[model samples]
Target chain A: MIKSKLPKAFLLCVFTLSIFIVPSLFAAGTQEDSSGNPYAGKELSILVSAGWMDSRYDETIARFEETYNVSVDLQTVPADQYGDILQTRLLTGECADVFWIQSNPFAIESVIVDYEDFCIDFSGSAWESVVPEARLLSCKVGDSLYGLQLWHNSPEYVMVYNKSMFTEMGLEIPTTYAELKDVSAALYAQGITPWFIPGADGWQHQLAFFQIGGIYEANHPGLYEGLNNNTATFKDNQTMLKVLSQMKELSDLGYLGEDWIGSNSTNMANMFGDRKIAMAMANSSYIQQIKDETGTTDEFGLFLLPLADNSFFPTNPAGPTMFGFKGTENEDLVRLFFDFVCETESLQEILDNSPAYTNIHVNDDAVQQHWLAEEKAFVDSITPDQMVTPVLQTGTKYTNDYWMDFGADMMSYFIGRIDANDVLGRMDANRAKSAKIAQDPAW
Target chain B: MNKRTVYPVWFVILPLVFYVVFFLMPSIMGIFYSFTDWNVRNRGDLSFVGFQNYIDIFTSEENYASGIYNTLKFTIVSNIVKLIPALFLAMLLQRGLRGKNVYRTILYLPAILPFLIIGLIFKSVLNYQDGILNVGLELVHLGFLKQKWLSDPEVVWKTIYMVDAWRGIGYVMTIFLAGLNAIPDSFYEASEIDGANFFHKFIHITLPMLSGTIMINLVFGITYGLKVFDIIYVLTNGGPGRTTEVLTTYVYKLYSSGQYGMAVALNTILFVITMAAGVLIVRGMSRKEVEL
Candidate 1:
């Protein structure tokens, strides 16, 4: 009887120990991955326009996935369709874990419309200091940070031209509208399309007018302020009229391109590689892209867009910015992702992978920059006063929201359907409409 | 036909409730919103402005009136382009033609594709500089025939029509094919016996018999044309200087830009136009039927 009791007791003790100790032992191993994170095995999704985040973020996200044991769904939308799609998703309360907006100082309030309800409050996050001071305005509303703008500070949307081609043709860089027309005529005579404007893109063609905001400001010192305050209008401004006339003249002469009105930037690099085109309104970083994509031996350089005789650097402090969705289920993961991207290693990795960009403009000094020599020379060439004013679309209130409409109007002007004054008058009307919508008392 | 099989008036109550809640209520609310200060900034709270939205549509510098005009033009032109050719194609495929099934499938394939896919394909084909259409024209020594298919304002509308017809003719033909199949052989044979040629048979027998099909096609075509967005959007996006700017494109732009009142007013105009056209056609067809 004693031996039988002993065997039963021994079996009972073994079963009892297995129940408690086995799970604890298993957890000890699993804890390495979970790290007490409830969000483990969950999915985090990001919605962004195509050019905003490409394969540059892929490796970083992969590393993040490995670290968190979580999956990341990166959705890249076409630039033209992204605004509508994002707004639709946002209004439907179906936005992804993280989403991006082409943000400027006023974009968060005007574009997002209700940033408080939508964007996560990352005011005190570890990544706050990494954002440069100039970008802070775009990332925050009343000092409560809502976005992370991880973008390059390259001269945005300036004329990128083939230096080799210009040298071969004995053409000097144009510094005025008259010189631009002459150069364009020269290039057109050589059977090379000059000043290639992808007007069909519905976005690119307007840069020649908007990127030289400093020129506008210089001509009329109080124009940006007046526009913001609803005290001024884009209508019949002589400088603008001159610029519009220049663009129309280019379009009329076919110097922009044979089919520039229906062209896109898809084959632009190849166009440069083949020396079929001379220059285009593109980011300074595009010079590297042209070399990388087409394996072109020809050197490229940047020049101020000479439309309206403007010499200002396109000092746009706006960029494609990422925001954590306030309604996201994986909030912790979103926070972690933001933190991960801002780290020194990740920043360096992003800069290294982005062949289109030269540097990541952040406050972190640890990350090495890869600024191109041409870009550096271009930067050095600019006077301190040249960078004083932001680009027109971002500097003025509610302007960027009507970007497509303005582009269309510009198209209308280009094709002679509407005159220059009509284009400017329409912009005034649109701004008034948005001002009314925003309930701005100034309107 | 059978009274006993018919559901009672009270039986519709459940579905009526759903229809009112899901469809009717929202539509009425939308119409109400059209007159108000509704916009993206103030979604919940709005004030009635009473025809101001409509006034803006008619008078705005953006030329909303042109959008309506374009919509109307498209409705008339697109139908004329599609229906006549589709009727002939249907008649051709309905009868003893070699490889009828293969031909039918080949024609029907485009109709099944989504507008997005069709738009992308057409956009690539219609690209001005290096598109296959121009490249092919050059290769075959017909280079001068290659026009700026999408860019030139004079050609953009024609290009849109061409693309619209390509995708739509197949579907329209299919409907006509069904109508043709429904027509008994005895009528054609009887007409043949009476020394009627193909045109005579078609006019006297086929057309009168297929009046219902024609009416159905007309209504479908008109509505599709009025609400056309995707094709124009993908190809030109109301470009070549708003030459292709239709009502729906204007509405989309306004709506997306937080001008909901304007968007809805534009929509209301579309709604009225569609309904008015629908009523006129239906009434006309009914009178025709009575006359016949």
Candidate 2:
């Protein structure tokens, strides 16, 4: 009996010790190689615009922090002030370890003209292969990768209208510019706001003109190439002039909301829910947002922005992208962070966390995409040929750099302070200024 | 006097160093940068461009000249709107009113609030379609008087002046109140015994006595008006088609868009204008004091 008891006691002691010691052994075993975990105690800082990162990156950033035993300092600035703040910080050499830009093919060359001096070249980074081919233009400045763009491919800046409201009014969806005008007039006659232009936002009103790049390209043929190579100018562009004139006419006729110029988008979703406005320019995802915010079962649908009789899609591949700052002390950590965010788990976590987004456009098949049914149907309805290159702002070389200036010019034109031709001329002058600053050979 | 007994030169050394470093160095550097082709593209490697930035500011089709004109207009008009009423209010509330402290607190309240908060509150209050001001007018059967407070170019400047005055009058009155309090009651009493009316007493005793205070307010108000950015930026953002574009707003736009050299040139221009105005006002006030 004593011998049996001694054996049982020894077994119990071993079992208790295993509970504490085995996990430690496993933790020690899983410790990465010295080169792999070299940045255990370092910190990484990222500066971004408000909505760019939000909480979608929280889970992935937390996972990365756990894995590397490091912390990430995320600094978010208001959208309107981000450009000025980023430029100032960059000039002062006090920029964060990582910074973001709303990047396109020409953004690195035009927006951050001193890319070589400021951006860390991630030419041979492991995560390069994860990005899609088309997105490479935004991330690379001539073969050298300077940014990491992980954004969705949702239908952007289309006409989102209340389907129930249109049906209730017995109005068919407008397919042409003339039809749109007629619908707007009918709605205006009914004492309803036909179209809502939140001009106070300073950025929203320009989409009606730029999103119809297909119309401009079809009319001018080599317009994007000409604009880039300095062979053509926004000045005397007949299609653009027509679009601007039509927009102003709508404003003058009061088809747009009364005091639209003085109004902002704070109450836009509520207005849509209450049926105060018929249609507005927004992303396809904003339909979901409106439904969610108002808890209204109002059926919303997307249509091509019918300005200038445009039937083509606004194929904007541009989005806010991150870049590693060249002047950071923790280069290895920055690279690690980049790689970590591209992992399958991290990608999935980001997509799952982003309630505003439905999918993440990436080349990896391991990541499951959550495409909304409404967006999918809209995408399917557009013809293959009509899905052209990006909108005018993102397609052209330096045009987007002056988006705010063009918006201001458009406002000035609307108020009769400046002529329509003068507005176009100002855009030309702005493009020339950007070309000069970039030292582009085309200019 | 023994050399040791003389005031030590070190007494002024720290402040002199601070002034040179903080104020003088930055001003000189700003002037120097205005002469170069300093921009975001070049960053630290700026090239000498002579007066190209200044020429561009004046000659460019962007209507920066209008901005300069607007700045001067705002300075003169805004000061006139505030100073006269502020003086009258100061005298009215100087004595003989119940709840004068309450009135004083109410008036001084807006001065202590940040420009950002004031802008946010007033922007909402002044909205055209659903704003309290227009809505109240509509409810009172005065809908015809409801104007587009921020959108209409014809009325936007007037609206801005109103808002500026609303935020500024109380503070200006407070300064005048301090000056009013400093005056001995004997002068006013003596003037009253001499059978002088309120206007006559104001012109003679109050005006002459408060000359120093007026000069101080004038200098402060002039500088504030010329350097005005927050109010206009928060209100119209130099909008309704650059109708309210002031020098500082233009300078801000240029700087934000990476035209650093041109921005500094515009600032240099404003600095010169402000200095000239200050000197002229000081000299004029000094001459008046001597005459008195």
Candidate 3:
């Protein structure tokens, strides 16, 4: 009788202990996590394009997760498909806490056109000052800030060429389109691709035409204003026509590459190291990348792309900008993330982790920058007048959104399927379509 | 027909309700949306724009008309390219070929592989500079024959067709193999006794008996052809330029650009095409059945 009674008592004690212990254990965990933080158990989701926020931000994000005891869901979409996917997610009202865009000054007004409805208004946030003054145009639609631009203020998409190769070949950096053609011819004679324009990259090839917006503005004064005011169009623009013809001429000569349209820039550094190519359209920082990646002792330098006699610097203040999705359940958490990313420690971490960029463009005084001397030299060489005009795509309204479309049109023109005029005409029509959608009075 | 072969009305009622609510209603709504100025911007309310969207598709300088042309061309050509080879392969394997099962498995392997994987592989294989095909050609004495397979406007469509055929032929052939197996060996044996050669037997016996299977393939091929997107998208992305852009790709672009009205219009055009093709195909099959 004692033994049977003991067994029943043991069972009852075990069940009662479990009931008391389990609840307390959960309560302890909850208290521990939520003790010092209001957003301890919340989640922050970021939707970004593939290359925008890579593994460089992983550690920073992890730190944020640990400090706040929160989880971050990072959804990186492939660059080619990001636009469609973002649009789909936004349209379906299922967008993440944060989303990113390849933003320009006109982007907030043009791309995320319904910015007031879509983005969280961070007008008076302390983090707004961390962003550089030049970058605010891309980040702000007006006095209201919607995006955080974390990008380098270095020369972007300039002609990064092998200085050693050009010197060895007895060639000067061509300042005119005709001289550029001659340089290409001389390189092609030696069984080398003179200009490595990776057409397969989808958006790389159009840089030759659009990066020279200053030249276009110089030739056709107030062209940017004309374009924005709807008093002008890309169609039948003689300067644009001349530039297209020169690009076609290069294509016809096979100086761009044996098959630029079929190839990507995956092995570009290796190609540079091997001295198989003389030059390419790349950022000033790509010089350092070539040295680090391929150990190429061959010195590389930057030049203005000599397409259509472009002597101007591509003064682009645009880059990948992140915005808070207004529809998020964790609005405070989203705001916290924007603030967290702007902190000096986080800024330093991002710059240290980013191998592609030599310097961070933020206005923080504490963070040390590793700016290349090559960049300084290139900037010094360009005249003050030359740097006045922005790149063609960003200067005009609603142009950057049609980047991929224009690239496709350029590809067609290069392959002999369509004339140059048709490409220009399509851009005009596409811009008009954007204007119609925006309900812009300028149209 | 006996009542035993027929199920109760209530048996189908649940499935019918599910179809109407989930599939039929959404499709009808999509059609309705196509006639309006509904887009990403105007999510709150919608306004009717009639056939203006449809008119814009043909008239717009975006050259959506060419996309329609490419879609139709791809449909006809891709079917021809797949069906004939699949049929022949099925016939060859149906005979007493040694190691037939091994061959069948190997051939059907590609069919099981997803299109995304196939596209990535082919893009590498067809790259003009460092691709295996061009390199192999150069390794041999056939370097002169090498062309910019994907970049050349002339060859881009051909490359797309080739890749599509590679992925699809096995599936087509598998269906043909099953149909061939269903055919009685007695038909061929009887024909052989009557001095019918292989060609004669194929023309008289095989063609006549395979009519039902042929119709099945045609119906499937036509439908698949009309909705073709993945192959074109993965391979060239409707480029070297928009030379390979199809209606679906265009629809996707327009939709992504937030021109939902235009996108829906393109889709509606595709819907009309598919419906018309379906009607013609069904009528043709019915007439053939009556004749038989």
Best by DockQ: 3
Winner of 1 and 2 under lDDT = 1
Against the true structure, what is every candidate's RMSD?
6.9, 9.7, 4.3
lDDT of 3: 0.89
Model 3 spans with C-alpha error above 4 angstroms: A1-43, A69-71, B1-6
Which residue pairs collide in model 3, if any? Answer: none
Clashing pairs in 1: none
Docking class of 2: acceptable
Whichever of 1 and 3 has more DockQ, that candidate is 3
What value does the lDDT take at residue B164 in candidate 1?
90
TM-score of chain B of each: 0.95, 0.95, 0.96
Lowest lDDT block of 10, candidate 2 chain A: A26-35
Give the per-residue Cα lDDT of candidate 2 at A389.
59
How high is the lDDT of residue B147 in model 1? 93
DockQ, each predicted model: 0.50, 0.42, 0.63
In TM-score terms, candidate 1 sits at 0.93
